[model samples]
Target: MVVLNWNGADDTIRCLHSLDAAALETPFRVLVVDNGSSDGSVGRIRREHPDAEILELPSNLGYGGGNNAGFRRAEEMGADEVLFLNNDTVVDSGFALPLLTVLRGEGGAGAVVPKIFYMANPSLIWYAGGEVSLRSGLVRHVGLRRHDGPRFSRPGTTGYATGCCVGLRVGVVRALGGFDEAFGMYAEDVDLSLRLRAMGLRIVFVPSSMVWHRVSGAFEGRLLRKLWLRTASTVRLLQKHGTPFSVPLFLLLLPLRLVPAAAGMFFSRLRREESV
Candidate 1:
């Protein structure tokens, strides 16, 4: 497991504890990468989990760059499959086996995302594997913020899978050259999944494996804040892929991406009962 840490010591420790508890039989070593946290997170980790390998970076590289650093190290260490998990998530009980089973057994599956839910309320869905909008050039996580039900059992291909708690085969990671650091953070997962799909590989969601995530992790508040960053990432995506073949399609469907943010903003206001 490669977990990126940036002043999230408490959450990272809790997440590691959850993984240790859930993975009693799985046999995994954790590599915790600290992206120049001034909060003494590295000291805390060394004190609490002395067994974990600590990689201390000199500067605060963004999410994509930080994780890419860890990924490269893991690959160098001969890791067969790397689990890229957010520091703010806790692994569901006995989740690793199911995820490994799916990744190892499923033919043509290059990457897989676990069923994710809000950490505080596991009953609410965070995201299930699904497609990104080709027309609007938006990435949609299937069943996000919905209650999970029988519909989750149907496994299928999505245009992309989320980076939060997703597993990727080492071969595919090497093939696609890991994640694009240009993403900085947002939409890196979508870009990776899309690239894998374009290479004729499958990116899937396995319902049986689960993880609890803190939605947005560090960024929590107005929906526009989230949307603006994602929009910037989307623009980066277009720069990488949009062209004569994709420009027309993305132009026609791009507006649909805004709907989710608008709806999210409305709900956020309702929850707070006040507009800022």
Candidate 2:
């Protein structure tokens, strides 16, 4: 498991503890990569979980760089599959086995994501995989903010599996050159899954394997910043995959990509006005 930490010591520590206490029987090692944090996150993780390997980077590599570093190290260490998980998440009681089971059983599956819910309220979903419309540049989280239900109980193919808690077959990922670090952070998972799909591989969502995410724990309330980063990543996706019309498609879909965030801000303003 690779947990990327950027000045998020508390959440990283909690995530480490949760993984250490997981019910899965697989022998594994956690690699906590400190993306040039000044908050002493590396020291804390080392002191708290001496068993985990600490990779202290000299500068912030962003999410893609950090995880790719971990992935390369994991490959060298003979890891058949690598789990790229966020430091602000808690693995469900026995998360690994279910994910592995699906990845192995599904004939063409190259990766899988666990069902994710909000850490603040475990009953509410944060992600359950997502559906993306490349034509419209619209992506929507499956069951976003929705309560858990029977509707999400089965394993299924997803447009993309989130990076927050996803497992990938190392050999395949490495062959494809790992994740495109240009993504920096946002939308990297989507880009990876799209590549796998284009290559005729599957990305599965395993609901039985669950995780809870502290949504935006490390960078809360920075909507505008995240929006631009994600937008830039999506644009790159078009340039990389949308052949014959990449530039024009990017221009056409740019504003559509911001719709959800814009709608969110619009409603937030209305609520404040009503309360006033």
Clashing pairs in 2: none
Q: Looking at candidate 2, what is the lDDT of residue 21? A: 74
Question: What is candidate 2's local distance difference test score?
Answer: 0.81
Using all chains and alpha carbons, the TM-scores for the candidates as numbered come to: 0.89, 0.89
Each model's backbone clash number? 3, 0
Q: Taking the tens digit of each residue's C-alpha lDDT, what string does model 1 give over 1-276?
A: 899999999989999899888768677778998999999999998898988898899999888888888988898889999999999899876888877887898588888878888765678787877666644575677887788898976776666788888888888888888789888768898888889988998887888888888666576565668777777788778767765445556656657757866786556445334322
- Residues 118-146, candidate 2, lDDT per residue (tens digit)? 77667978788799867656667889877
Give Cα-based local distance difference scores for all models: 0.80, 0.81
lDDT of 1 at 53: 90
Provide the global lDDT of candidate 1 against the true structure. Answer: 0.80
- TM for candidate 1 is 0.89
